[model samples]
Target: MRLLAVLDRVDTAPFTLEALAGLLNRLGPAQSRILHVAPSRDPDYLSPDEGMPDAAEHARFEHTVSAQTDTLRQIAQEWTQAVIPHRDTAWTERVGDTRTLVAREAAGADITVLSRPSPQDNAAVAEAFAGALYDAGAAVLIAPLEHYATLGLRPVVAWHPSHTLDLALQAARPILERASHVTFVIGENAPMEVPDPPLGAELARQGVAVHMDRFLLDTGDIGEQVRQHALSAGGDLLVMGAYTRPHFIEWLFGGPTQDILAHGTLPILTRHAPLVRL
Candidate 1:
């Protein structure tokens, strides 16, 4: 699968490069593009009391935007130099509006990888990118800040009977194909009704080493149990479906899906889907 990674600056967190490289290795040396998005200047810089001619303001705004674009181009060049020597990977950097640039770069890509930004600095960029890619029907891999470098081939699938499971698995197919081992953790409180076993059989056919375990806990912390199981199994990646229940249900019941999204430290592959019925 072709992988696109969005990088602005060098990541300071440990293992970030390692994780990215590991993921790239699994994808088998496809073209990797690093898109650098530049911030646009505000055209509303004129004083409210002053009535400036429309044409003059437009010309000034264009000049400022052009200068900013040039600066971003230089930054992109420097970024390319820093990343090129570190790996045997192709790198390219383009500067433009982040939203539009990302969409263009991701157009034909099968998957995109994004590093989670610090909470303070434009955190919405990553989130917005994730949603845009998801809407575009591209698989997105979000690397967490803490464990970016240590993700290996060992993975744990957080299974449920919902349709989200299928989408999540499909999005993670590249990793699953390369995984040395995969464990499916079934929560104890998950509906007593089990899902169709065909998916398990299909995974086995793909040569995945699959194991199923029943998670049991009386403390009502299914999220904790899932994390513990993944860690115990030596899994570096957690594969699970994204939000499954309705908004109100999630608000009232506190779904395990939300809990994992908020608390899980491992790299997660998630896909949105409708609820699956037996």
Candidate 2:
């Protein structure tokens, strides 16, 4: 498998890279590339009419790039040897727009791995996360800010019937196949529009142990409920679709994706923008 790990800023938690290495180990032998993109210019750093930064401004940008590059190299080197020995891993940094560069790199990778965005994340980290999932049309694994015990061992699904969910399942097939058991947190109040080939039966055919946890979704924050269920069920990872609603609508009235991103406790594997699949 090909894994792309995107780190957009120097101050990002070191545990994020360590989590990627740990995930690489879980996936077995795989080619992993760690990419860090230094912003060419910060927001409103200079106006377009300026035509380029003055000498001092250019020097500052260069300094920031150098620091970012050094940080990535050190983290990748130390963790590759300490955590994922014998794994094929490479690291590099470039100067460009974070979103565009991340999307370009993620398009060719089987799964893009990155730190989960917190409310405190700066513009770049959030943009990188958005790029990998929405712009690149790729599956993403979001690592927690702290260390995790396992990934893909026991996965909990936030079940729903939608094209985005279908794409998420397709992208997460590899991890699902490796899970010891899978749990589906289904909403009793929601429609059960099973596809032509039922997802549960298909997994059962593959010899996977499956269980369903049905709940009433009539009250409370659904996202919070999903997260609490996963934690109580001892789920190491949460599998689900992302951004089911339009961005503006989601922002206006927060949805599951926003809630999970803000308060989820476990690692997450998800995809976005259903119609566009890679």
Candidate 3:
């Protein structure tokens, strides 16, 4: 599989660069495109009525952009030099609207990796993430500030009834097949028919260690519940569907996917928007 690991910003956790490279190596031998994207230059990004930055602000921003671009280049070059003689590993800095660049770059990628939204994220950071899910035409593997474990080791799948869930499972099949253990966290409202095809049986046929159980999620605190449950279960990765319906639905009522995105700690593997078939 060809993977696109987008380091949407350079100013995340300091060790994030290392963590990103570690994950690249962890995804077996898949060809990877590592992109460290520059912040957007769109004047209307934050506010529609806002005009272009004044000369002073523009100068400062340009300086910051130059520095960030250098940092990204250095990090990628150093890592590339260290891993000399490797094939199918490319890294570069992309400058444009974060949303448009990420979406366009993710077109044929088998999966895209990105950092989780931090509490300190500004508007651009948040929008880039949402764009990766909604416009990438691929699945996303969300990474935390720190590396917890490999991509699929002891994976925890949040199961429900939807085409979204099915797509998530299929996209995650490669990782699931290599998992040390797999736990199916079924929500209370989850359809009983989800197990009709017997998801466990399907995985078990491929020799994956699988187990299933129901989780009573406190509707208001679903994020907290998911985190606690995954931690208690010794989960290293949390897999689930991204905003399954139209993005508008998630904006209106919110959903487990958004909640988990907001609060989840484990590396999450999920797919949504223009769902890509695996």
Best by TM-score: 2
TM-score of each: 0.68, 0.86, 0.81
> Which tens-of-lDDT digit does each residue in 40-137 have in candidate 3?
57344357567667888888888877887787677666666665235456875777777778777776787777766655655566556666678765
Q: Write the per-residue lDDT of candidate 1 for residues 174-198, one digit (tens) a residue.
A: 7787777878888765554455356
User: Which candidate has the top score in lDDT?
Assistant: 2
Q: Total backbone clashes of model 1? A: 2
Q: Which residue ranges in model 3 land beyond 4 Å of their true spot?
A: 13-26, 39-48, 81-88, 189-197, 217-220, 245-255, 275-278
Better of 1 and 2 by TM-score: 2
Go through the candidates in order and give each one's C-alpha lDDT.
0.60, 0.74, 0.67
lDDT of 2 at 174: 75
Residue-level lDDT for 94 in candidate 1 = 53
Model 2 lowest lDDT segment of ten: 244-253
Q: Rank the candidates by TM-score, best first.
A: 2, 3, 1
| Candidate 2 C-alpha lDDT tens digits along 169-232 | 8877877887788888876665554332367767878988887877677677788788888887
What is candidate 3's local distance difference test score?
Answer: 0.67
lDDT of 2: 0.74
